[model samples]
Target: MRKADRPLVLDVVGDRVTVEHGADVDVTATGRAALVAQYSRGNVMSRSLLELVRQLDDGGYRCVVVSTCESPEPLVWPGELPAATVVLRRPNLGYDFGSWAVALDRYPAVAALPRVILTNDSMAGPFAPIAPLLEAFDTGHTDVWSLTDSYQLGRHIQSFFVGFRDGVLAEPPFRTFFRKVRVEKEKMDVVHRYEVGLTRTCFGGGYSMSTQFRSNDLGVGAENPTLAGWQQLLAVGFPFVKRTLINDPSTAPGAENAAQVVRRRFGVELSDWL
Candidate 1:
């Protein structure tokens, strides 16, 4: 495998966490929010992630960026970070699931808030305005929602961009699921047990769930809709192209042209990430 395709192995120690407050982070800001779980080896924040953060900020959500990285190095905030947002640095353990679990535990009060978006830096672009999507999530009747759904290994909302409203957030099953989340070394284990598992937990708890982009609606067949039908997704204003498509286009046979397609059509440059 090429270097970029290698699985990341961080210096993980069991559940050890440390916190840092950005110079101007709204330490007092609390309420309806978005928990953006991020992992960056070079400590550089991507422009796409930054754009997504700005959109959430504009949408009136408190942004809590959780960077799951090697421990002990102080997190240096890029001046580009919004002043209102805060940063939480922890040891990389359970991927995005672990980061979200830690962030959710840190801010217990967020559960009571009307809406909470659990997202991460797994994809690129907000090439389009996210206002419409956020509006649908807020007003939609579903207890849990996501940008898209996939039927890959069993139906589940793609974990990269899931939303939790009041009902699901308050459910015991929701809290219990996170409380029981363990650090898994294998990425697919994290997916099956946490990513897909969260969706199962929500349904088992009797919570209504929906997605802005349904798997069937895409009319595409693949384990991952984002990777298989990326062009179709973008054509529908999906707002993001899976980052893996750029990192290793061969992961999806026809997606090798994604970098150029995104640049030419959406005017979003993903070449830097490649």
Candidate 2:
């Protein structure tokens, strides 16, 4: 069968997570966020992640960045990172989860911070100030929240940007999950281990979950995130735009694409990183 048409199967053989057809991710735990992000490349000309870190810092949120790449090399920052930001670069063992583990193992100070955010350089913006967004979530009113929740793979909060308050942040189970996670190399591994795994753990542990963008709640259907969906996300104070639509555009095409429309209609440049 063609690789794409083949089903992915993972079997746990003792300590090794073997896959049917996949590559290995060497998640090296060299170090360890109030707002931790996993950077994919060594040198890139994008200011989106840095911008988010700055915005979060300005809002008085402690921020740490775990810089990494698929290969073990020196990760580069385009500009001077704030002193409050603690950064470590290593091999991309487990994608975001590997980065998360690096942060937890290296920095014990953030191990039990009252609140924390796990995010990555997946999008572009803070098109507007994020203080209001943070204000709403940081008020300690919700146990947890994210910019959005997805029904893909399963009903799980998209891992790009998830915030945790003391309820789950201070719990033993939360840290344990992070500790035991494998350096998963498969896409399904990420979905099952981190995305769905984290959400279920938090919810099952009695922590409430919330999001900034909801289609039904906002009177919008998932017709096309570019149609009015992007605007809706922006209007709700979301700080970034997914790079897939604008920067690479795996889904949209030509002028009809969401990135081009966002630029023409809203004047929001989604390729600030490019």
Candidate 3:
């Protein structure tokens, strides 16, 4: 990692860093990969998170998890992650985007994979097999695939769950984008600069994109579909629900029914994820 690329921690935690090395799986041989960014205040892995990784691995993705926690020590593993899953621990600093930037830098091999999925703990479930759909989408018509697209800020692939195909990661602009990613103090600033900026970069580089749920089909105006249109998304067999919708029901209208609705629809108890 370059000195400049190293994350600049602004907190009083000093420069404490922990890098738990894992057996690096050659992504080139794996054919499919996932970079999952995670953050836990107590350094404990949640069941929902464990399920996410397991599902990805079951779908043939070599997963690399970059976790950020208050403590410098590694995250508490649930003993469920595949043996090949690489876990890296870092001080909570630049949010998910920051953690992802660190992972990309640490494992350049992920960039070479023919298909790669970038996701985070901000959402819940693969309640269904999504890898086949992603593989289907990677046939070259789309350079990027996302579970859902949003229009709150602009038309961009929602960063929480997205896939990159056909060497989009190898593009010079794509690499430069991650290289230039910095720690943004405000949450919205990170969303604007990185989340939204990512799709814009792809567009500039002439990369095509697709989404499972279209914003127009879900919601309108500047509302987030995963929040405002979650029920509709779920009704359409969308396998995941955003954490914001469940963590604080008041954050989104009708989210108060998440537990009941999810249990009835997907037959998976929401309390399990909570």
Best by TM-score: 3
Q: Report the C-alpha lDDT of model 1 over 155-223, residue by residue, as the tens digit.
A: 999999988887467568988887677767688988888888988998788888899988787776656
Top-lDDT candidate index: 1
Ordered by lDDT, highest first, the candidates read 1, 3, 2
Point out the higher-scoring one by TM-score: 2 or 3.
3
Show where candidate 1 strays beyond 4 Å: 1-15, 23-30, 71-79, 272-274
Off by over 4 Å in 3: 1-17
Question: What are the clashing pairs of model 1?
Answer: none
Q: In candidate 2, how many Å is residue 92 off?
A: 1.1
The clash tally of candidate 1 reads 0
TM-score of each: 0.88, 0.76, 0.89
Global lDDT of each candidate? 0.78, 0.60, 0.77
lDDT winner between candidates 2 and 3: 3
Q: Model 2, 1-274: lDDT tens per residue?
A: 2434322221121223212111231112211145465656445536777777778767666566665544454445567655566555554456777666656655555655556777877776656677787776777467778877765555677777788776366467776777666656576767777788988998778778887776455544444333235556655555556776665545543424655645654577755544
lDDT at 13 for candidate 1?
34
Worst 10 residues of 1 by lDDT: 5-14
